[model samples]
Target chain A: MANGTVALEEKSFYEESTNKYSGILSWLLTTDHKRIGLLYLVTICAFFIVGVILGILMRLELIAPGPTIMEAQTYNTLFTLHGVIMIFLFIIPGLPAIFGNFFLPLQIGAKDVAFPRLNLLSWYIYVIGAILVLISLFLPGGPIDTGWTFYIPYSVRSTTNVSLAIFAAFVLGFSSILTGLNFITTVHRMRAPGMGWFRMPLFIWSIYSTAWIQIIATPVIGITILLVIMERAFGVGIFDPALGGDPILYQHLFWIYSHPAVYIMVLPAMGVVSEIIPTFARRTIFGYKAIAFSSLAIAFVGYLVWAHHMFTSGISDTARWIFSLLTFIVALPSGVKVFNWVATMYKGSIDPKPPFLWVMSFIVLFSIGGLTGLVLGSLATDIHLHDTYFVVAHFHYVMFGGTGTIFFGALFYWFPKMFGKMYSIKWANISVALFFIAFNMLYFPKFIMGYMGMPRRYFDYLPEFTNLQVISTVGSWLMGITMIIIFANLIYSVKKGKKSPENPWGGVTLEWHTASPPPLENFHEIPTVTHEPYDFSQLEEMKHESK
Target chain B: MNEDKQNKENHEHITPYSTYVLVWLALIALTSITVTVSGIDFGMVALAIAMLIAAVKSSLVINIFMHIKFDEPIFKVFLMVSLFTLVIIFVLTFFDLVNR
Candidate 1:
């Protein structure tokens, strides 16, 4: 009943006498899901920094003319490493495994995710995968140049560390599958007594949907990457075009997982936005069932649209048409989500807060990204746009604009609860502003240059594209500087910011019912949910009369 | 949280597991028969019969193993969504191949 009042309560979990140890041991050997989430926060930040630095370097190399700093081969290795690190390492596991793992069980009024040890195991597996990839970077033959796609024949013929790279991907895919399996079981088995399926938060719904994509799709990538490794190492002919194997089969296998893997990345970000928008708007989410079902719908339809990525790969015209149509179908659910979010904010007392602002920006940027995606989905348009900077800009607009923007939004929304301290929101706002401008400036020219026949993954380009590339390079540095400022603000907050209460944002979710940086065991007693999440009116009535 | 409602519901009797077993077994037997018939090369007749048997088998599996037949309508909706995805993927892929 006290939980219905929307106030933070200090409990045994936050007691000074508890075994919540200080320093490295607390982080390394902790079983607390919050601590583990923090560990992920730390690890992913490091990986993100590495990935961002790679991006800056790549942009710099492309700045002046013909390879300013590194040679073309080295540039190839840089972007390949960048793509592999950012996609497989950072974005795929971005929102769900880290934040969803930390927050979902708490949000659903459960003590922990269904399998806690397996949750910890996922982190270890992820680290091992990261280590293997880094090792591949140093291996003989100067890292793989076959791009992250690792298309066969090129992968088979290339004199790079293909086995090491693909094997690392295989390990990471296993980690992804295990995380997905754990999330599915937890959602099914671990909800509290009165917490029905419909009562669950939109964030949890997003994770639930993403979990299915992971369980069903990751294995195909695993098998595909394994066959590539076999072809490279053991001389198995599954993907080897030279050895009676169809290279296109390799593309089918890779995109089957990889395309939906994009959904896996963005769906959770959408979940993050759903949570942010309602809390900030001070209202119940508009059409909760529609938004929740849309997440699942996106995940379902997302699987069929992968072949659209292959349309320009010389697949049959019929395949192209089918994939094109399916691609349009896939956009419908995402459209539903965008519409629902706007409707949720329509008449509500809107909070111009950081998270809300980021969500709004996400809508604008992701719309551009999503609409361009439809352009690429059209068979005729994609033929011209395929493998160009148009595709590059389109993807980054969705990915960076979609997932990357939400990553910052979630950091601001939940940073207090996660760290038990509030970040400097002024700095946070500045970071968002600078990031938005720089991000667009960096990627927007890509569309223009791409249309002008500038191909992606090339170290050198014609003189015609020089001015646009120069402007984009400047934007990349601004983005880099903004990221550094963000890191500084985060560190400053951790060391010395206002100690936060549990319900800092006044959110109407079970997570807000618990302590900031919740306990070793999340709840003192298991909760029985009564109200739906985002019942902000009830929360308001309770808060005002009680005060 | 109310446990009393759940206890009262549990007191009411339902169909026995033996009935489910019989249904499952019968479905499996029909599946084998259809597979055998298909081997006889009855042209489109064999293919149609085999597919019909497969559908019956899947229904039985969902009804018994997955227990959707006894479930609330929402569960049917969820199951339908999953089945729908399978249909979309297979149909589109089939159309792509056949048309090509």
Candidate 2:
């Protein structure tokens, strides 16, 4: 592959694109999208582990009612930190900040995102925001214990350093906005010669939709967080009821962004599934236009359902029912996606790789999560299950079970391509199995106990709920072990795994046309698409070229 | 390719100084209208009138000063999508508040 001169393919991205810096400075200051992606991957994974440990500690406290592992105040702080780190530090940036940065340009046949400098700036802003959140923990006011929602009256009055933490979130919102702007520009201006809108990969479509949500919805949260910071730092009557600010209005503002923000978390996961299902099934994706358009539909409908979270929070009956109807309406596009994925797999050659297995699990678990969400979306059922463990279980099944699984699913599918090495497939399979079982055990019992009237965010429970609590605690332990094994398998592979063959899975996306751990600029020559995305007839040609 | 065509359409616009001056004058006049309406106290409609004038002023800046007029049609579509999202949020929130 190497000629007399330095071609982009002669050196892998790891050894190329230094941007004139060397050593640690090369990484910290590098504007290479791939390197910056790895930067986000490492940081986000660290926050994920921190969030997981906080969760395990919280579960330990609930193992036996009444001061089992810590004080009630300590329990309050733990759950708050868990939600904060998981949602903001981990999942919000989980897929887009990492894989989207790495693969979006590659899939679109662009050398890099439209604004490479702005892309790197997004990562730096993310790091600065993360640091601010961490610094707030040790500050004099104490850790933010208002839960991730930072619901006001309490958020405004809490003695903890809520202002700094909310300020951190405000800064993170900037990173989200800038990243979104970069992707939109990239999609609009940098698509390859023959890559039409319909010819592009579904992952690009989903992330494109997610970028719009990030641009449109994130600023709302940015403004809401600033208001909380101001009301706390000074006596601004914005959110505090005592100061004549409406607490309900705060709920309205918070959910307006945070609800659509959930789509920001899941839309890309859905896109990843759309990519993987067809590759494993060896078929063109069914209803390509339908899947693509549904992404936009989901984003548009997701905005109207924000008030569903505020259904029980003193919102008017008209708003509650209308939002409830819209919440149910949002399920239509998700159903379209799930249907298309399963249909694409029908009567096609299917390979049950770890990535495939993870998504298969995602289909079942996320369905349960989305369907159970309807129980909450119903105005009456929500009033009953509003703050209970049922609510807790519902989101976890969707979020942790949904996006969280696909996050790793994508990592496994693209791991070899990203690192030029393959993970231990046997161990990867075992880890996914353990994860599925452990995850169900941890959250499933919450539904039963919650129906029996157990509320969330509490350290103690009735003696009758003790059995399920113990099961949940043990499940958390199992989940902790499974995570460690998955990391061991992946971390070891990053350094010592066997070399992966090009087009290892015979994928047909634009990214697969190039070398594994592709060169700094991604391709030896830019590809001009002539067939639709996921046309499996191209697989044989890719296999021939790779060899 | 479509992207190339779009690129060709971009970075080629040259707005005359006269256009900028006209847009700026229109903005200033709209601002005075906003202030004038606020003083008249048209009750609840006062805020709506001010917002309407502000919207007109912004369209002048967007179309002329910002050069959206010279850009491809796709950019105008993008602007509309963003504004549509904002309008939906406001209308939906007002539904709750007005009913309450």
Candidate 3:
């Protein structure tokens, strides 16, 4: 086949117009999965840059104990805006919408998602949500001052554009639900001949499991957001204490979705690590079934442990004990995954590439996040750590350090295949080194100062926190500067870099078998699978040839 | 593909009109029972009974009107899993509420 498809180079999705539309209109109106994936990649990365800038600014303000830059209300609005934009616009829809939408069909040996037009519609919905958030900032009452959680009463009372902002989140959740439904149906019915459940990639498993959480957990956030809007609009008193409604109920409903939403964020990143680890290690995956099932286990147990976020919010002791136990239980499956990834690397000819290096950082940082998570998970320690920077540092470690690191890894891992371009591996490694060092300097101090009683989301702190705050602030600048190098390298390479080989990573997955920047239909003829997913022995002739 | 289609066609379910009427009557009867139970208020157990009735009514709607009775086993598995997850959420949420 011509580069794993019957078509010529002109038939690739990036080439001349197959559809009538071309240029910007082709992009907007096109339903091609790869194009939509690129669209999302650009959009979310733009939002990520904005979020990072806001974060750097926030740290700049906090560098001094007193008001360094903005007013207290501005700081409040800034963090809220930062949280809403990052959570709703960037990360939540990020890996799944970008990678999952792009690769789910490709990985499963299908031409496109089960519903192509619906796939496009979900993207439109996501864009609509992003637009709504942007418009809210300029609206009459100003942007939402409540955090992304939109804890009620405060949300109801806040004199900001809470309704419109939260309504955007509701719309975003709808997009997630549709995408979940599409992926689940695609996986169930659209696998190529002989590509059974076990034969699918671990990334598909993670995405599939995440699809369930999207379908099940996302609706709770949707409902909670609507309740917040309703209470704000009509004095519904659903969550207002002054009107005899319960505030705690809002926290419960919010985290019920948001907590599992963390799994939604991290699981696909885990799936990426699973794909990268085996490829770089030059070995068969250690425990494919174990990792696959643990994704599901984490998804399920993740749901049952949402109440852990509410431990200090006046929930019952029964709830505290029950949720604490469930929290520990959820950690088991995550540990299972970390164990399997390490085992996969054991004794293999490790490549030490950019992606693998990111995974190495992922293991160390995610484990720190996970281990400290146990401290936060316990009833006694959480009492000490609750609402402190410890909690903030913990999530950033897990979410940003872990999932965020792998985000870079997956980008680099797939960039060659996606763009048919290769950048300097040496430069990529330099960026990763700076990224890890700056990341630790930024968040690790918060863990210590947090334990010593530094509260989260404050305008001013005691004099003692000043030094650590300055270090953290300086670290943010380095990390922000490093991001420009990393992203600029990739973007420049897309136009001018060397043409990547077809199977650049010697990946045995369906995506690698096809051309770099595969044809519009993904494959000319969907190939049948007769072997295991990670059976490297079958691909001896396909060993990676470095460019 | 044709054989699978034929098998699916052969297994297609068509409930009798009388069966639909019977389910409708059962739903009505359950709704009446829920109303009666609400009036007599057996405290905590009453909420459980209400949910149990709601569950029965929905399952009837699912299996009969939704045609899950003649659908593939996987559909049934999905339905059961969804219901079980719903129960888990409710029980856990109420555990906090009641204990508090």
Candidate 4:
């Protein structure tokens, strides 16, 4: 129970590693989890920026309807790259790869992940996969215009570098698998003595559930993408209708993995929300077991509902009904999580920090996303909304509004701990406000346009869709400015901000027990756990100590 | 070092070498039986038989070769959950195709 002990003599993780290699090589070749997490951080941020730019370009093209900024082919490629970079590189790996890698072991009172070298290898594989994607962009036939899904027949027939891009995704899938393996092993074997499964932080539970999906569901995408690459390269005839392969079969295979991949992206974000809520509310989490078990329940039910994405793909009525039923079922667990979070904050001394604000926005935005998902999950309504901008809006509400907001919140929550400096809270809150407003403005119109039958992935829209499109584009510009402000505030704070103490927000987790910007090995002496995670008495004790 | 020793003690389970041999033989026997059954025109039943044999073989590999039998109950539970998920996916997907 060594909570809030100072190890002033110990060097921070940034200062050195056990490895003899110094400077950049220490980062590049090190097996340290914190360093590797930072590696993932820098890499995903670069990709996220690239994705945002591609997205803005697509929005610009759509702003005025016909051929505003780029030609039809360029627009197609831009959207394709935008989806690939965002889904595969940024959002899929966003929270888990960065924050989970850095914080999981720290929170569990372990020195590093179970397979530290394997952790480093996953980052390397991630870079290699990312490089392959970039290389495909400049290849002979031009970047793949096949959307990130790489739906069959078109993917088979496209002369572009679909094979390379698909292969890039395949490599990325392997990286995902290894990371999942590392996390699962770490969680199973690396918890501190006396830290039973229930005693562990809810964040660990969410990450564990996500890891299960990653290992079990990701291989389906790996094999599916390889089949596409094979079909493109050698006419394997697996998905090509002309070649006796069923296109719907391809849809089945893709969603089998891709749908679960959605949970992979959002489940960890939900875990972040759980962590932030209890800390800010200054109370033990409400329904801790319910929230923890709901994560697994989501992962379980999530796998069964991938076919909901195929409702318009001419799937059987039985399949559609069953999947639609499962889709609604999946929503129950998510609803449980949301309700539990709200209950946790009930009548508590809520610290209205930037991170908590983001969590509040997450509850609103993700609820909108989740509720509209029910709209799309219903077979009757999905037929009308399939492939429309409504679908696009629903997705962004969930992915960007839900996961993206939480990612920023987690960064805000942990920034002081990770960097030993506090960012400007005023600027942080201002950026979050602008971001939330601009985000809704940007994507909310899509719900209207989509319901009005505005088809997505189209280069031109009828004049009726013009005004809403314009509003969305203006929102994108605001988003761009917001991004600039947010990143600049964080970047500037790293070098010049006030130094953070060991427990900045009075967090009760094991991570708060150690130094901010913890040592390379994460702890001076591995702590033995005695209390349940989010136990408020620890926070009360720390507060008294400060006085 | 003490933690490492404790972890090793927790996870290291040594199965009898003869058990692996027996599981390997069973897997091979199952595979050959499946191959021989494919010659008969039992139609859909033949496919079911083949799958049944494959399932048994996999369980043997998982439980014995993978040491889930001797290792931890949690490992076996997760293994079952993973397989159950695969089954649900297949059954649900076919529900659409068959009904349509």
Relative to the true structure, candidate 2 reaches a TM of: 0.96
Q: Higher DockQ: candidate 2 or 3?
A: 2
Model 4 stretches astray by more than 4 angstroms: A1-4, A543-547, B1-40
Candidate 3 Cα misplacement greater than 4 A, ranges: A1-10, A16-18, A541-547, B5-53
Interface RMSD of each: 2.1, 0.7, 0.7, 1.0
Clash count in backbone of candidate 1: 0
Candidate 2 chain A least-lDDT 10 residues:
A1-10
**lDDT, candidate 2, residue A479?**
99
- Model 3 has an lDDT value of 0.88
Name every residue pair that clashes in candidate 3.
Answer: none
> On residues A57-105, what C-alpha lDDT tens digit does candidate 3 reach at each position?
9999999989999988888898898898888888888899999988888
CA shift of A104, model 3, Å: 1.5
Q: List model 1 lDDT by residue over A162-205, tens digit each.
A: 88988998999988998898888889878887788899999999
Lowest-scoring 10 consecutive residues by lDDT in candidate 2 chain B? Answer: B1-10
Candidate with maximal TM-score: 2
lDDT of 4 by residue, A1-547 (tens): 3453556777899997859999999899999999999999999999999999998888888888678878999988998999999999999988989999999999899999999999999999999999999999997999999888898878888899998998999999988999999999999989988789999899899999999999999999988988887887788787777778889999999999999999999999999999999999998999999999999999888888888888878888778778889899999999999999999999889999999999999999999999999999988899899999999999999999999999999999999999999999999999999999999999999999999999999999999988999999999999999999989999999989999887888788888877779998888778878788988887666555434
Higher-scoring candidate on TM-score, 2 or 4: 2
Q: Which is the better candidate, 2 or 4, if ranked by DockQ?
A: 4
List candidate 2 segments past 4 Å from native: A1-9, B1-11, B16-40
How well does candidate 3 score on lDDT at residue A259?
Answer: 94
Model 2 agreement with the true structure over A1-547: per-residue lDDT tens digits: 1111123246888887657877888888888788889999999999999999999999999998789879988888899999988999899999999999999988998888988989989999999999999999999989988888998888877899899988999999999999999999999888887888998899999999999999999999999988887887787887776788788888988998999999999999999999999999999999999999999999889998999888878888888888999999999999999999989999999999999999999998999999999999999888899999999999999999999999999999999889989999999999999999999999999998888889999988889999999999999999999999999999999999999976688788888887778888887777777778898887766655655
